[model samples]
Target: MVSDFRRKKLLHMYKFLDKDGSGTIDKKDFQLAAESMTKQRGWKEGDALYKESLDMTDLVWNALQKAGDANNDGEVSADEWVTMWDTISKSAADREWLSQYCKFIFKMQDFNNDGFIDSDDYVAARSIAGTSKEDAVAAFQKLAQGKSKISLTDFQKLWDEYFLSEDPNAPGNFIAGKSSFD
Candidate 1:
């Protein structure tokens, strides 16, 4: 059974991906998020970075649809999202999807393409999801554990903890910022 903490985290992730404020997540949501992110980074439509961001978002959306859209309706509902996580949680072999997702997110959040995510990068990424600067800073501090930045390897561990840990005090609980699990 999924713990309440893990369930909350899963739903939070679903909400984050459903960028269009619709009840389900579709390719359009991914496109909107990609556009928003590129715009925030000042990447114009024809820019290589902008195109890369779009491609990354498309890849993410395709993976998510394959894994979570159980009904094959071209969208992932909240129930489908939770059920997918619940099943994945029980199967150790099913974690490859999560690792790929973590890589994509890490790439997006590493604004400088420097292989690390600093507090500024964290704040900027969270800002796209409407998280306040203060909350993002606090969450990053907790997740970083006093470190100045988080590398991809460390982020993968935190990503696992975020999706799997039932502990309320887990550092990964702050992955979406302070308010997410509060």
Candidate 2:
């Protein structure tokens, strides 16, 4: 069950996602929201705008459908926001898969393989991303404002917030299947 605070947070998130403040989320809303989010992440306006033009709402809708659309009405309602939060909740959902993504980001950020990420790691990540340190820092700060450091917990949260959240037409599924070997 989702707590009231979390429900409110989800509703807030929904408001953000509904870029036009139209209440109902459709393809354009998803595109606009994604564009806004990517831009907020320090992506160049030209680049983010270019990417947003690509139509792929079906992909995003598919990944979020089960959780975001509780009524299964092909649209996300206010109450269904809580359901999406349930999926995002570490306690309510799978941890192993979440950690794998976190580890991936940790390795990427740990540019020197020193087992921890510091400012240098941030620089390296920015270099690889073809963005400046200022831009990278801006994006990080925008995402995690006022935080003193980026720890494993911080990485885990970022991994979920940015990487796990799928674009409407992204290639892979956001929710992974159970291990076949299990």
Where in model 1 is the C-alpha error above 4 Å?
A: 92-94, 179-182
lDDT score, candidate 2, position 148: 40
- In model 2, which runs have C-alpha deviations exceeding 4 angstroms? 35-49, 52-58, 87-153, 158-182
TM, every model: 0.90, 0.44
Clash pairs, model 2 backbone? 59-168, 60-168
Residue 46, candidate 1: alpha-carbon lDDT: 93
Clash list (residue pairs), candidate 1: none
RMSD each, Å? 1.8, 12.2
Lowest lDDT sum, 10 consecutive residues, model 2, at: 173-182
lDDT of 1 by residue, 81-109 (tens): 88887777778766775787689889889
Q: For residues 1-182, what per-residue lDDT tens digits would candidate 2 score against the true structure?
A: 66553344445546655767778665667666556445544546567433532323435545566546767777777766565657666464544534653565465466566765556566556555455666565554544445644666666665564423333222111111100111
Give candidate 2's whole-model lDDT.
Answer: 0.51
lDDT of 1 at 81: 87
User: Relative to the unseen true structure, what is the C-alpha lDDT of residue 158 in candidate 1, on a scale of 0 to 100?
Assistant: 87
